[model samples]
Target chain A: MNDLPHGLLTPQILVELDVLERNIERVARTVSAKGLALRPHAKTHKMHEIAGRQLEAGAVGLTVATIGEALTFALHGVGDLFVAYPLWISDAQAKRIRELLSYVKLSLGTDSIAAVQQLARQLADKKDKLGLMIEIDSGHHRSGVLPDEALDVARAAREAGLNVIGIFTFPGHSYAPGKPQEVTDQEQHALGEAARLLRADGFELKRISGGSTPTAELADNSLLTEVRPGVYVFGDAQQFELGRCQWENIALSVASTVISRHEGDAQNPRRIVLDAGSKILGSDRPGWATGFGRILENPDARISAISEHHATVLWPEGQPLPAYGEQLRVIPNHVCVAVNLVDQVSVVRDGEVIEHWDVAARGLNF
Target chain B: MNDLPHGLLTPQILVELDVLERNIERVARTVSAKGLALRPHAKTHKMHEIAGRQLEAGAVGLTVATIGEALTFALHGVGDLFVAYPLWISDAQAKRIRELLSYVKLSLGTDSIAAVQQLARQLADKKDKLGLMIEIDSGHHRSGVLPDEALDVARAAREAGLNVIGIFTFPGHSYAPGKPQEVTDQEQHALGEAARLLRADGFELKRISGGSTPTAELADNSLLTEVRPGVYVFGDAQQFELGRCQWENIALSVASTVISRHEGDAQNPRRIVLDAGSKILGSDRPGWATGFGRILENPDARISAISEHHATVLWPEGQPLPAYGEQLRVIPNHVCVAVNLVDQVSVVRDGEVIEHWDVAARGLNF
Candidate 1:
């Protein structure tokens, strides 16, 4: 552990190569064993290095949240990409998407007739080059239409001369405690129903993508042709608390230092301040989440509050508080958002930093 | 408004130059009228263009949250910079800080004896060149020491041959509902008591910094020599909801397009998905916040849920839902985090793109 340089900056993301590789291999192995394809979401790491590793581990392609992210990985030499979002493309973006199709197989999600028709009009002659996935609402009612409503979007795509590849659903509700298995069942049911309806309408469904980090392992291979689990590679505090992964399975952590310490008083509790906070770790706390984040060195130490650059940690009772300037690894509550906050991440193996990977698609939200 | 380019990409930040200038000038006038120095925290905008405007508006200096942010502005010709955080500097950072002091009037915050002693040891002969401000906890209870405890930290700085120039506190509790005036009073009391104690110990203090966006206007200018207000430059949903600023006072908003529309059913309510989400808007909803964020055009519309690249918005009861591909301006819950999420912001005047300002100090959270 001493191999991590002293005087190294705080709030720097360190990706443990050994653990990261193991995470990638394990996910790939599980998917392959079930005869299901894996298209690991690149939105979590957003680095070509991690995407390359996933592809090397037999992933069929990369899954991204936006067309910009797809273009990034495509430019990085990834030949196949799926933009798993209901993209509302502008004419300029359509031109870029057309250019991207020249070098890669591109697909995007759609849940509305207006969006599909708009995409068809924007793509014009290039419509055939891109594929479309009908998004279905599977308990997580953020985006996506109901299962029965998938046929309307698919029909719209067909009428507009666009290719309807398959359907997908995000089991996001699994993020809550004791919901993984239940949400997985909902995901499978939604995708299965959408596929049944689309197939009955003589649509050839080649892909059925589903799964978030929490429900990926529990995904039914018969229903989901591929899994797009983004956060499984990093395994954040949310996943750890949800029992989706063990603490040892976490591969990425922010190296932070205790900047100030305060002893308990009547009004104030015993606490220490860490350099890592919302700006780096990200402010993403689900109502069910225990706190803002977790201290990897001591999980019992709770992050009571987080400001832009200050994470106030309540030290575990009876445990010696970290001295001022003492380093601690902080696991963000949501790894995806935290990773997006940084431009690059340090890749380490057995405490030695092997290389640094640029978060090539860091803010490609468009 | 149609001057905004057609087919512009979604999830893009638009900084309205007219509103931005007015906001800056208003704050400058307020501080000038109160006879208080205005050191606008550049952490909110992080762009040199905005900092230049603030300085031109008669700000005493630029306040940053980290040393890296200070270095960015310092390199950009911002001669006066204060890193208002209890920075526990490493040896390499100390060297960089010393190099910065050669050109910029650099001051940092400290709340611990160990941190002051460490800085003294790191700087060695260069210790006299740097100034320290003892941080006091008015009510934020994050990083600062208590009002009375500020003297112990100051004594340590005085004993270590470091310059203790003044004291500072962040009345962050003002962010809550109905708490701005109360927090401002607490801030004044804490700063007054800390200054009194430090002055009683025969230490001459020059600076008494206090204020956050919520409490900056309510600050007692008689007690605080200078006030640091960051989020006022580009008002966000938080400030607007807290009744600190009017809706039209907001200077920055994300341009987003409706991607999907869902009519209400027995199971789900009517909603539409936007291209902007947590990845661009940032996930920062205070417990007292109304919702995740707000649609600038329709304040009644609520961003019910936000994923990586999808914002699920609940359209108002009587208001017509935006058509698929229709664009709208979205105000993020926290403008500071939202600005940091993007690499560059498009400056607009009368809807025409004026310039693209780089977020030079973005993600420089050391």
Candidate 2:
């Protein structure tokens, strides 16, 4: 991979392999010491190489959002896989799921009784055991049934001969700055209530999974059996902005060159144009984000706009801006999505190039 | 490629060889009838297999946006390539450019004399053989020199001993609905003026190119030497909404399943959820776009919101909503970005599965 030559890195993401391993170890140790099962979400680093590393770091298993991701990790030799998203299984997808279940210990999520019933009908005669988790909506309204609705889903799964494993909730609202503690508490409350409801319905709740990166540190492990933190392994602009991580903790960045420069009007004095744009960094600026993303070398230079080929940055005063052809690294706002935008990432170790890892499972958004 | 088990097409994009060939033939024949040299941009369909077919369909050459893309194409034996973006070359990039120049005819675009000067310094010895195209800013204010400034850059390339081939511009404004004719007219005017300016500078302009899929149908071949249209080969939601293509012309789609349904309050009755969301269908909704993208089978269902894994669709009143586990095909707003978001596309031919072609260049965004 290193023989390909230098400039071959275009719209390329550079991940310091050593730093990534450090971050993974830090999170795993924290969760393991807290007596919580660590299941790093594979969505952040979709590559099998990273997944293998996480498993070696003492993670019990891996968490994925899509059936496609579950299949990818399973093929890569990951034994225990938790598909955290509430997935609807069509006839075609059911067949694929059954095949995946035979190869790995699979745990699926469902928020509704109908969904649980549908899954049960499909898995009735299958020899492989399928574990079903009742999804409870902690705070994020995207998916999951309310804590009160968990019993019905768990009952439905049990009736279908599917094992009613436990409950899981994604405290996505924890990503907002200063809200991690509150969201984590809410998550615990929701999961505890769901567990009680499932027990009352005569189902054994073996696990109560919760905690994203932002809330992992604040999770009350007494109520939860496991935690899933994806982006902690590769801190991004969002984590930095939320004060969840330090700059040195950031493991991935887009190494781009200053392609052009535009001295704006007196109102906007300093501006530099980068070869990295939305196509490279991804046009994903959350409403709360300060800019498109963050510049690693020049934090003062804010990304003002993003065209397909150029990233327009508004440089801060008193800072000498990057000249044309100068290289700079940028940490994207959302690292997982940014990683998905490229084919491979250069693994750098202590300023020297180590290897290039193919994002084998990239673009598997299905 | 087709020897895998009946349902082994897990995460890889399965391309029906016959469907892709038909799509390529249709677009090639359409442009051929118009007497325009068809040079499909490799940015959309990055697979070399598809590009080879385009070349076989009488496409003169391939158009790429990045040097990395050109290198990938060149590695796959595509000789004639046009790097369409204004590339800023550093010492590191210059070395790669030199290597590429050794194998293929490389035509690069530049909008500034300073950029041209840098290219000249890099290609000092091989200037006589290298190709340079001056870019004109036709309405999109993103990049490119003004038509009036094209001569200065062309003269700079000539002084640098590089061949001033022609001029090109991206009529990005053509993406707006109902503006294709106007954008095409503006593009032609800019190209014609730039050509005249270069000719006045005593430089022979061999290629005058401009045409996005939206403007291709309205482009006047009498004034240009070639036209580069990328998205026409596989029509997308943007094309369908802009009146550039019909429902039958959309050859690409995300086959997603309905995961949930919400029977809303009396004021808002029906809403269905799909597995596809921004992660699958890109969140590229121009202000004028109807929604994030469009549902191919259910035009009445409007995609109201897209969370990470859930796409909420508001069904029209009295319409039969898709039941849980029902599959729906979604045509994304921008085909290029959407295709780049996934590792594979299921190529369907006459409703029969065929070969699973890997998107080898899936994430070459850089």
Task: Determine the C-alpha RMSD for candidate 2 after optimal superposition of all C-alphas.
Answer: 4.3
Task: Show the colliding residue pairs in model 1.
Answer: none
Candidate achieving the largest lDDT: 1
lDDT of 1 at B287: 80
Q: Tell the DockQ for candidate 2.
A: 0.31
The iRMS of the candidates, in order, is 1.0, 3.8
What lDDT score is found at residue A283 in candidate 2?
A: 69
lDDT by residue (tens digit), candidate 2, A78-155: 999999977766566788888888789989888787888777776678623888787887876556777877777777
TM-scores for every predicted model? 0.98, 0.88
* CA error at residue B12 for candidate 1, angstroms: 0.5
